[model samples]
Target chain A: SQTIHQWPATLVQPVGSPLSLECTVEGTSNPNLYWYRQAAGRGLQLLFYSVGIGQISSEVPQNLSASRPQDRQFILSSKKLLLSDSGFYLCAWSVWEHFGDTEAFFGQGTRLTVV
Target chain B: SQQGEEDPQALSIQEGENATMNCSYKTSINNLQWYRQNSGRGLVHLILIRSNEREKHSGRLRVTLDTSKKSSSLLITASRAADTASYFCATEGNAGGTSYGKLTFGQGTILTVHP
Candidate 1:
């Protein structure tokens, strides 16, 4: 079975501080990885997605960026954190199917609070 | 911009009662998927229904899709307290290209099943 692991379940960061959140999937190769953020009591916003290594697509313009360093390793980074950046960040992975990508599986998520 | 919108931002129901959530989306889709999220946790994929299919069933969950209306509904039967969570609907566009696999999520409906 495939499992996704995300680090730093919760983080408190100062404004303008650098941030790094890592997500890795074991037991799957060449999976599609995504980064989503959910504001308090709001819908999820897709920040970035990668179909392969070194390939990332940004859904909306923002301070955050995403990278897929390996086949199953994805990282979300920011050079400087903003107060608006504080939210629940979720990392998910899905496998490609004949029709499209299959249902996505998510990690526990990283709750970052920028103070 | 968000593509899907779920009705009844919050619902409260007694245990064993049926809970139904509706979602509406814009644009053509390849498939629609439902996900559940416990408080402060990542989402769990519950079910997926292709655009070609009108309805699908899995255990106590039933999903119905209406392409003409560009809407979908998720029905949870005999709900338990454990079923108290936020439910989200995500859509994968039918556009056959790099974007076909990307999922656009809706604002979720929070379901609270009281014991």
Candidate 2:
């Protein structure tokens, strides 16, 4: 069975502080990884996605960035966090085939609160 | 920009009643998927329907996709309180850009099933 792990279930950070959120998947390789943010009572926003190692595609211009250092490891980083960056961060992975894409599996998510 | 938009930003229902959520997308797609998210939790993929397929059923859930209309709908029969959560629609576009296998999500519909 495949599973995803995300850390620091809840985080409280000050404005201008650095942030790093990690996500790792077990039991899969070469899976497409994605990072999403959700505001309270709102829909999700796609932030970043990776199809392979060291290859990442960003969906929007934002205060955050993401990297895929390994096949199953994805990291979301912000050199200096802003108050607007506080939200629920989610990590997800999907299998891509020549035919198309499959359903995505998601991690538990990280709740970041910047004051 | 987000590719899919779910309708009826929110819904309220009772157990034993049915709940339906609709979504509309902007571009060509290989497939469309629906997901469920509990409060402050990661999303769980509910179902997927290919562009060529009009309707699909998984247990008590029924999904319909209309490529011509660029829209889809999810129906939950005999709803339960446990089904209370936010539902989102996502589209996997056929477009080839720097971002491959991207699942763009909509604003989501909040479903509240009162016991």
In DockQ terms, which candidate is top? Answer: 2
> Mind giving the per-residue lDDT tens digits that candidate 2 earns over A1-115?
9999999799999999999999999998899999989888777888999989999888889999999999999999999999999999999998866554478899999999999
What docking grade applies to model 2? Answer: medium
| CA RMSD, predictions in order | 1.1, 1.4
Model 1 clashing residue pairs (backbone): none
lDDT value, residue B79 of candidate 2: 98
For model 2, give the interface RMSD.
1.4
| Candidate closest to the true structure, highest TM-score | 1
Q: In model 1, where do residues sit more than 4 Å from their true spots? A: none
For model 1, the local distance difference test gives 0.93
**Fnat scores for every prediction:** 0.54, 0.66
The TM-score of predicted model 2 comes to: 0.95
